[model samples]
Target: MARRKTREEIKTQDKWNIEKMYPDNASAEKDLKESVSDAEKYGKYKGHLADSAESLADALIESDRIEQKLERAFVYSRMKLDEDNRAAEQQALYSKAAAAISQVSSLTSFVMPELIRIPEETLKQFIEDEPRLQTYRHLLDSAMRQKDHVLSEKEENILAQLGEVLSAPDQVFTMLNDADMKFGKIKDEEGKETELTHGNYISFMRSQNRQVRKDAYTHCYEAYKGMINTISANYSANVKTDVISARLRNYPSARAAALSSGRIPESVYDNLIDSVHSALPKMYEYVKLRKKLLGLDELKMYDIYVPLVKLPKKKIRFQQAVEIGKEGLAPLGDAYLQQFQKGIDSRWIDIYETEGKTSGAYSFGSYDSDPYVLMNFDSTLEDVFTLVHEMGHSMNSWLTRKTQPYVYGGHSIFTAEVASTVNETLLMKHLLKTESDPEMKKYILNMYLDAFKGTLFRQTMFAEFEKKTHEYAENGGGLTADWMNKTYDELNTEYFGPALSHDDYIQYEWARIPHFYNSFYVYQYATGYSAANAIADRILNGGEKERDDYLKFLSLGSSDYPVELLKVAGVDMSQREPVDRAMKVFSGLVDEFAELMEE
Candidate 1:
């Protein structure tokens, strides 16, 4: 087996040029420490937020300056650590950054509660009275919306001081999963053995070789199974923390707190679950069709990812994939494509998996830095899709950072997912329209169907599990390894239906999902995919106005409520129609795929 390369062994071009953000660790540490004094500047406005319009505007602007510096420091340190989790020096740098930010949080904890305490009439007049305060109308509005959940200043300060302690469960899980857990090795399709890592697990599952798929699945879950007890306890602690924090702030439930923070309606979450439940029959039909197409008597979990309609194998290498992505995503217009190309040329991507690298992909950077993407590219067509997906996120950041102020410069997961998935949608549409070969077209169709299955059906199931488990903890029930496994397994069976033959490996799945620690975040993938489908259709079928609207939406950042911001793109997420429409699309695609396979 080939040994995984160390960080230094990876090619220079394949890594992100993060040095542009900070020269070295010493510089990052220096900035982090200096930001401590900047945080203290907030003390000057503590008692005088409601004193006058000018004072209020000045305080908010000063806060933005301090936050920008702190964010840059935090982002630099974390990105450095993400490159190699085992590096002690990087770990220390990250710890210092986290501590610095937490201290800043402690120093400025009075800001939100104090803002909330101002009378609404007074606050409105302050905005009307000060022209400078116009920049913060939405910010103040958002704060007022959450006023019911704002605790006393002292309590807020206490929580800020305990920030790192409250984050212990997530930190413990990260260290254990990324640095400690090992899945050993598995035999590849040609009987050559290869090391099994998180980056290649999905590739193994999609291997035409069934035994390779089964082996990868078994080894991956078995490692989690070994640490299930610890994982369950750690996850329980995370849930407890979330519940207690929400209760302390007077939220009805942890879910309510999560949704309300972004001004999203709880009905949107429920609508996703309810709509997907109605569509599960179609999912079962697809699974049954998959079993028939594979000529298998029973479809096991490992059998799900292998493409049902086989196309000729071709290696889509990194450069080729980026070119294809450029072509596929060209419909987003020249301005968007130009920035994407610049990102490509500027070394804004870290492209490949190496020893001790964080698994999965993300687009990350502070407002002052280029939006950078981290990927594990194995040159599959699916990896091309991933490249475009993360680039979508980076493009969103790039546009938002250039156009919006620091306060609205980031994304709520709600709108963030839409940006990423829109790229995926456009890329798929491009492939389907341009590819001429019958088999290749069939493969593209298969990929599209699987995406719907994964995002709509699969993520909704995950959303339900998150909801149920949180409710369990809220009701004083223990989330032991056995109970979580049982709950997750039942959900799998319910979602996958009778076509799926259960395995022990399938139930341990929840233990391995890092997203569970993120609370109600997974549901956005489903919601966003739904919204993207609509937006993509508009751009393709409608006029230049439709394209302009989406571009504007991407630039809006968090300037408005997430659902309202999505309206700028012509998709209303508050209604269930988007999910219903997405379900219809899935149903049509399933019909098309089954007919092609049967032919």
Candidate 2:
């Protein structure tokens, strides 16, 4: 077997291509100089946007041009640095670009507040006079919407200076988890011991041996327990940052600040929690049933991942995954199906797992390039699902970018997951319809059921935990390591009901989940899966109109708020219908799997 690439090798592999982002250090220095000069030029328009519609048009257009170019340059450089931070030279280049961007942001931050202060009539007149201003009407409206939240330019300066430090907790925690943390030893089924690390955790969880799974789970948490204090401190700092910023900006609460960025209503968060709380008994029932099927007297955290039926040991090759994914997605018609084929043919994916490569999967792109996917293939069924999942994200990006301008090219996280999950749903549906082997069909159905249980029920539990933790912190509860562990343990018991072993190390789970730092993010995984289930059902049911609307939703991007955009696709997350429908779908899957196991 080929050895995994060392971190050093991965860095060296990219050094030549990394220079393409900036040309060289000299080119980056030049761009910084030019960007600063453009900021000064754009800054001349503060408070004067109402002077004339045509002149306001000219100023706003120039501002966007400079902003877009400067942003692209910064993003490219930053992405390069992020790809491999072990190289000091790349890290230094990132710092240089960041400092310059910071300085430019300080010089230009007052323009929006100043523009909003202009009289509405005057702004209207400018837009009426300049036909080109139509392109920016929405942009101008968004800035004005924050009129009440604007602070003095001096206060803005102070906030701008504090940006890096305010963001330090999330940054530091990511580096600590991704680059530094090392859990010691785990024994496999063969009675041999190996070093355990973050990347290997998934492989171990997929191990068929029940004992191996338990050992990995408990040992991983044991290592995390040693560092829980530092992790808790980091979590507390991140939550406090949200609270402080929300108050400083005069938002109603930290939740408001977080949700408003995605243009989500606070009630959406509240409704998700409320509905999930109401449905907890159903979730608890599912858990107990899972434990019963596993034939365990009492389950533990490690038992959650093992399939209710052990899947046949079938290894799926990387190329086979591509073909199956293409065939599975063919129901969307040839044009859409061909994109998957093109993605594979064009090498838009970086396939194969290597050392130091990022774990998990994601699709990313620059405005100038086609979206690219990164994956770690291990020939397992889950790895195949991951391919379809990430392709869902890539295809969404491809469709949106091809259809929309740069300003509207990206959707919020609220809608982003809908695309990915829709693809996964369609893929699973395709396999279920065609497969002939009973055991294989059962295996596929079980995987699909697991997806719903994990994404919908499990993540809602996470969302509730997030909400209560934030509320606790907001109401003066200190987020000590014990508090974090205790709260998590309570939630584990509540969500899992009496299915789990009480003595298990479920309390340490919070220390391992990276999403806690993101505050209110995990819930979207649940909500997104719900919405995707509804929309994908519509598309698969021969609803031409519904399919068209969903395609339009993909292209809508940030042109509207997420709720309104979703409404166009005929799913309103504001109501609990989507969640209820999704849960029923999940129950049906559980029933199917239960019947299969009985056979």
Please give each candidate's TM-score: 0.99, 0.92
Best by the TM-score measure: 1
Model 1: worst 10 consecutive residues (lDDT sum): 308-317
Residue pairs of candidate 1 with colliding backbone atoms: none
* Per-residue alpha-carbon lDDT of candidate 1 for residues 366-429, written as tens digits (9 for 90 to 100): 9999999999888899999999999999999999999999999999999999999999999999
| Overall lDDT per candidate, in order of appearance | 0.92, 0.75
Residue 245, candidate 2: Cα error in Å is: 0.4
Clashes of each: 0, 1
Error of 1 at 523 (Å): 0.2
Q: List the residue pairs that clash in candidate 2.
A: 53-126
171-195 per-residue lDDT for model 2 (tens digits): 6776677566767787866777876
